[model samples]
Target: MKVSIFFKVLCVVSLIFLAGCTQGSAGTTVEDSVSLSMESETKVDETEKFNNDVDNNSEENGDNALKMLVNWKGLFYNPMVCSPYGCYEIMNRTDYTGNILYTDVVTRQRIFLSPDLSADHNNSSDPSWIDNTLGGCFLFTMDDTLFMSRYNYEDTPGELYCMDLDGRNRQSLVTFTDYNAPEGGIASDGQNLYMVLYKQDKQWLVRVHIDSGKIEPLKEMGGDAAFLTSAYGDTLVLKEIRAENTDSEDQMESYLSQIHTVYHYNITDGIETEILSWQQDKLLEEYSGEYLYLLDVDKESLKEVSLSTGEERMVIDALSAESINAEEIRSLYPIYDNHLIFDMGNDEGELKKMSVNLDNGRIFSIDPYTESLDAYGSQYLGIVGEFGDEFLVTSGTLEVPMDGIDPDGNPMVVDMVMSKLSVIKKEDFWNNRFDAMEPVEDVFLESMD
Candidate 1:
């Protein structure tokens, strides 16, 4: 009976040990499964987040896009208006290094869209300075193709060339035999490029087809006095300067010198109308719709003219006002219909920007146009152009790197300030709720009371 009891106790102990081992193994398996599931879920969440970010960026690009064409280091002139593709700017280079660069307005990526037409810049005196100024090249794009006019600054004439955006399949369009004034202007309407052709004693408005390279004379602009400034749509704007030198002993010779008149010609209607006329002065600074703003360049007065009615009135006479001098006003550019971006030249010679309402003659000071930034060296911020809801800016240092070497051939550097390009958006730029030190409503109320 005692031997039977001992065997029974051993069997029970063995069963208990087996059950405990099985339970521990099942617990480990369950734990491992749960850990693996959590890891898989985490990876899926990360992938989904990445995909969502991409989708959001695509959507934002589809809506506004905010395209801009920019050049670095202030090496090129301002580009043409932004197109659906991009903008074309002259890549300032030496004589043998002339090339046009295409910049994606949205991405700010630049691509060389022209072949190296640079001649030898290896002149003994400052070889790098040769062909370094590309201010003579003009670029415009149509239908994924770029049109470039490369010319020497000494000679105003240029050669027009057409090529793909990637600088492929280049073909010469037209070569002006005579001097082509830069002020004569070059404009494109997708179908044809209208440019001023100066041959001998006359100036002709010629239109060249992009695909066929056919040149057609559209209108005879005028003599040495009449030349084109800019073209909008089917209308061409020309400036006519006439010298009025009469035999008057009392009149000053400089006073009877030259008169400037701005005229508008319709390409479709063939009608010529005078927009602004002044005696040795600029009557029109800028225009919108049927209204044109006239700046009394000599008198420092602001006036508006109606093209339809021919009525004119003074908007502001700065000389008569006490707040600011007319001479102190350095620049005035319109942003919207009723607002202007005014630059007041301060005592430090820096341009201070302020917003002015044309209707009420109320002025509101904006934030300091530029901000000082401390980088590796000194830096500054600059305001470029102010659009309706956006403004272009640039920031760069005043220091010049590797300027020139002394007799010892050591690299020379100097303190200089330059600016790079950027864009900022301001939705309330036109509204009175803008972040201005002085509100428009408060100014209006003070004037009323």
Candidate 2:
């Protein structure tokens, strides 16, 4: 609530400044002069000083310090759907014929394509439920072809469809009759597609050739499996049940209740590398290109492991334990320019971003808001999807100010303004253009709180 108040004041000042500059020559209004004076009076030299101190502190520590800027804002879309190559946005609105809309991020031009497949796989009683068919993970190949895994509850074997970028030629790659395809099953490497299938007793990770319908077992990890990360080139990371404890065995004595291990499988060589292991004592927070970062609850320290050498290092200790009363580490993610963003859970069970630090351990806080007081609890203000230098962040009570932007750009705000989607430029964030003044620091702080 305090953070919200700060944002409100900041917004009022910004609006007054913009109004005075625009209407000064037309007429000498008393309100305009007052607004200008108010803007000047609210300019806290201390705020700029604090920012300067942070910048200086970072520079003194290391030259590898990341320079961050908040550039543009728009609705956060899945990053995998964009970037490296390029991607088009697809929204499933419950209006009209339910067409798929595509837009180029660079040019901001809208490109319309015919619906490759109908949303109604099964003509259900509710039309809204029929539109659920559009929901699934999609990956575009280097050759500019779109591949998607569609789920059909009615049939035994669901479908994997491949279509031209413009939704032209369509073909079904493979259908699995024995095993149901998991959601977000397909991960591709331009040559082959990997799909995770959930069987009765064990989980199987299968690879299917894109060109041919040939399917083969990549690796079968016993127990439940959840998708974690993709190495982009050839490796896939999966979280699998390494060991399980049963009631027949001594449950109290056995330390291994449920251990989640991150395994890297090379699709090309068919090699499974046990890069990192997490037991009840240690937990993984996030992973970058070469490092797997974990939070040790028992030790109260942030740990990192090199994926190549299997060497572990303690980076930082959770010193401010009393101030936040954090019970567990909620979310750990990597930001652009190689910064680690971590969230900690408070006594109320709400999670907030605690710190943004580099691999070497220089830390900074972006606290601007108080944690929302709601019975249901607050959701994470995550950098859900990213592309190039930009990423999408969803925030607030209603997720009202959901926008995507490069945080390392000049002040430009792209106001989605409670619409289905809107674009905010870099200038808006820097200039404080929105009526809603959610400061970047405040956004981060609220997340941590």
Candidate 3:
């Protein structure tokens, strides 16, 4: 009996990973080894996902135009190539700047919200190249008007600029004296805008009355780190990660070690309730009705936590018998109602799309890319957004020419990927078939330049 190429490669990868794991201390426990392995595996996945955004064409003079093929009004996503450290650089390593391009799904038109919003690279020797200051922006539409806040990490604390959808009627809304940075996550209730402000070990939930320009700090959320997950309808969800000092000798180092906890705060009732605590390095967030769903990528499972009782139950397991291909799911985005769209890729470099019924735990494998669209053949990175009974998705791959020179006169070719935006009817998607005659447009935006 002979081992297949796949198995051989898998074995080699495992061996090399184990060998690298031994570089730690000899007394490193099995738990630590497993944790390190999981972290390393996550990094490898991120690298692959990062690589999928490249465009392989060697010529740099091609026309980079986008198309408009959909007229569905809903929340469309401007896909950004981001990493664990910060925004992923395209073109070259020296190019640390990246911008998000938003599309008005209703008008089938693209919107350029900000020009100078970018990530600053902190000079860190770590292989991950963690970003000290990631680009921060709060973008959302309310009452037919778009409101955005562009905050530069390099600027002073209280420098947030607000603007409209057409880049007109811009004004400075807030300037910080010495608060922690705005997480760049914001939510609005048609009347007021909400944001999470943090300064070392403290978090504050605040809202700015859009018309009056009155800013009020609502609550002091105590955590080493906090994220404003979602703000919609009447409820807001926040995920807080706490740092506890394990080493009494060095109190500062103890705070470096942390655990995660989630909470739900109701704007109507003015009540903040603790929901669930996470064990793994993953963070789960998605609010639906009376429950908030939790997704753990490392565990390949999704759980639903009750907002009232603080109880949780596993809903879907990507590695279990019910999943499509039983493959690890990545980039799970929630559509309207109790539906979730996720990406699935295999070792053979094949990308797939899967949707799960959050209410029933049923999974459907879909191929909305049936219409002679540009797939790049290797991988399909799809971004699914909801609009009524239809979905607006942008699918494509990253390509690297494998030959080029860096700006600093060094030999380097960077990864560049394009997005092909299209619209799919909800019924058509669940039927496992896409109509070829339908409008399948390519989204072009000036921000990619």
Alpha carbon lDDT of each predicted model: 0.42, 0.40, 0.44
lDDT of 3 by residue, 1-449 (tens): 11111111001100000001112332222223334434554323432221111111111111221101110111123223211111111122224322334333333332222222222222232111222214443333432343333344555454554444334455666666556435445555546766777654567888767677667888887766666664423666677777666556786566546677776788777798776776434554555434566777666677776665678787876646664443345455434435666667778756677777877888777655433223224333343344334444443322323333555777664444334444555566577555521333222222234
TM-score of every candidate:
0.56, 0.59, 0.55
lDDT of 2 at 241: 57
Residue 151 CA error for candidate 1 (Å)?
2.3
Best by TM-score: 2
What's the best-to-worst order under TM-score? Answer: 2, 1, 3
Model 2 Cα lDDT, one tens digit per residue, 207-308: 677788777776777544455343333556666654466543776545556677777776668888776566654565554534566766666677777655
Residue by residue across 1-449, what tens digits does model 1's lDDT show? Answer: 01111111011100000000000111122123223323443222322211100011111222212111111101122333233323334433212333343333233332333222133223322211223333355554544565666553555456677766545666778665554533334545556766666656677777677677677778776523665544444565666666677555656664557677777777677788887678753443654433556667567677776654679877777634636555566655423435555566768766566666668766666544445444322222333333223433442222212233445766554222223334344434344223321110111111112
lDDT winner between 2 and 3, please give it. 3
1 or 2, greater by lDDT: 1
Candidates ranked by lDDT: 3, 1, 2
**Candidate 3's TM-score:** 0.55
Backbone clash count, each prediction separately: 15, 29, 15
* Candidate 2 least-lDDT 10 residues: 12-21
